[model samples]
Target: MAEITLVEAVNQALAREMSDNKNVLVLGEDVGIDGGVFRATAGLLDKFGDERVLDTPLSETLIGGVSIGMAAQGLIPVAEIQFMGFACSTIDQILNHAARIRNRTRGRLTCPMVLRAPFGGGIRAPEHHSESTEALFAHIPGLRVVIPSSPERAYGLLLASIRNPDPVVFLEPKRIYRLVKQEVPDNGEALPLDVCFIIRPGNDVTIVTWGAMTHDSLVAADKLAEQGISAEVIDVATLKPLDIETISVSVEKTGRCVIVHEAPLSGGWGAEISARLAEHNLFNLLAPIKRVTGYDTVMPLFRLEDQYMPSTDRIVGAVNEVLKFE
Candidate 1:
């Protein structure tokens, strides 16, 4: 095992995959010579040559559109959008083509493309750079969405997404890319795509979250332990086909929940989790399920961003509120 940053792990994964599979290719802005803005693909171009590591023009639509075409023709395309926010510009192509080609062509065509996007805030980036748009992509029918909180998971899941026979949106949490380091093997072994991991075991309250918020939940859970509260922290690694069973099982035991995220509260992914919890197992709710998330407003600039995102105090407060009924 080796301790590596998330960025380095991803860079390793790309290099390893390209070495093993000649058909695997990467394309995105500044990906060739300059590497990515985050340096996730820093040395890939030097190793694989321009054909496999391409630097496309500043056009996300073309990136998404051409990726679908390349994948349909049997080349495994690992396309990157500089930021998660930038990918929104190509929603038309993603939803209309990359997402629907398998069913649209009645199995004659398969678009096995991985759309990599660096997302989330806390680095004080410009507007739209920190937005968590997983909910929007989850709403799409055929696209698979995955987020990795640790360096190891990032490498493994990304490799899995590239090999899977469907379009996947892999959201790499930029905040923890280099800040959070973990011991990951050099080989990019893939993870099972349809399940969540229980990072911490507990029986009091379940904290459901992903991406950057996973770290927030971990911090909050640690603090809650001081107050004699056991909050089970479950990471929804695969956001699209959510591991509903694992989540429900934890809630079934804990009997209380606090769905958290960096995105705004109203239509955020937390809302969907809460709705499903309320509908399927009302009796298990010890208190009304709580949600600590961003406000229902545009992601503000760095100055006021703190007020827009969830915090440890808010999570602690929610857990305290649930405990009051006990």
Candidate 2:
């Protein structure tokens, strides 16, 4: 076991997968030679060689289409978009073709491809580099959207995504990419997809969050504990095919809930979680579900980025507001 950052864990997963499965190939802008914009694919080219680790032109549309073609032909391609913002150009290929291949072919074919991108704010990136619009992908019918908040989860979830027999949108939260380190075994074990990870348990309030926001949620939970408020924290690892049952169980016990995310307040994945809880677990609630999230506007530039993202105080405030109801 080795203690590594989230980005390093991602590299380890890619290397292990490429080693175990010869059909597993990696391609994207600078993924091979430059080792990805964040180096999540570092040292892969030397190990897998030019044939398997490819560096394509700066065209996300081409990368998405090529990955679909390769997957259809039996190659499990792991394509990278430099940033989530750049992924917008590939929406057509991902939604119209890659995501629909299995259904269109009536199980005659499957598209086993993983699209990876660094998302969210906190590193002072310029325009088109700090997007966290995961809701857009989660809304798509056939694609799975996965986000990991820690090194261990990043390793396991990425392995699961690559091995899955369907197209997956793997969003890497770059904000916490190097924020923490944890011991991760390189045994190539894949964590189960479509499940929420209960990071902490409490009886007062359930704080549901994902991606970089999970960090803030955990911090807020600790702050609440100091103030005599017990809070459970859950990381929604897989946004699409959500594990609402886990969330429902938590809410049933705590009788209060607060959903948080770095994405905009409107139409974010948090809304979906709130809706499911209201539909299936309304009677179990002790307070109205609250949301602590970014504004319903574009992610501000570096100077004002922190203001736009939800803070630990904001999460605690939301908890306080929900707690007041009961």
Candidate 3:
């Protein structure tokens, strides 16, 4: 029960799963020799050996294809793409094959693979490294998109994803890789998927967010609390099969909602949550739903990077605006 960062928790989960399940394997660029771009797979090579941990050439598309093949053949391959920007090439294999394998084979084959990538901005990385295009994967019917906000959830949710019998996109928030630490037990237990975790309970407003944005959202909630505003915060662990029920119940009680995300605002996952709330919890709302998100533009360089991402001030502003309606 040592305190660990989010990235360390991820490594613990992978090691535990690979040790318990011989079929679990890890493959990706620099995953074996170098451990990984961010070293999320650090020290796994010695522990699991080359057969279980492979370092593939720098080709995301190849990694995706190979992982799918291994999965169909009964191996649980946890493939990693160094960065989310590089993962774009894997869309062909992921969308057309991995996602549809089980349905296409009519249950004869199930693609049990976990595609891992470090996503989101805040590290001031160059172009492409800061992409937060989770909505793209979430739109794919057969895929499950999961993003963890803290070390505990990262450890638990990743275990669940690896054990799942379907293809899962496990997007790690690189921004918060070492932002904070939590006492995470290496118990091999997993958190349930397709559900939301209400990290903070309140009654005035519901602040919905995931990934790195969860950090800022929680900060905003604290700021609101000082002002006598009790803001509930929901960490949407699984985005695709969204646990709207948890969100709806929170909104129903709070009667106000503010969705947050690092992705550009036009069609980010926040929009999907907003739509679901409006459709089902319209009458319960006291104020119009608001979204505090990134602008509809490319993630800028270091100078403008902080400005582009949603901030605690912005979240509080949105909550205040919604509160004004009441």
Output the lDDT of residue 265, model 3: 92
Count of backbone clashes, every candidate in sequence: 0, 0, 0
Give the per-residue lDDT digits (tens) of candidate 3, residues 40-122: 99999999999899989878899999999999999999999999999999999999999999999998999999999999998
Per-candidate TM-score against the hidden true structure? 0.98, 0.99, 0.99
Evaluate candidate 3 by giving its C-alpha RMSD to the native, one decimal: 0.7
lDDT of 1 by residue, 107-178 (tens): 999999999999988889998799888899988999899998888888888888888999998999998988
lDDT score at residue 119, model 1, on the 0-100 scale: 90
RMSD of 1: 1.0
Q: How many collisions between residues are there in candidate 2? A: 0
lDDT: worst 10-residue window of model 3: 297-306
lDDT of each: 0.90, 0.95, 0.95
- Model 1 CA lDDT for position 202: 93
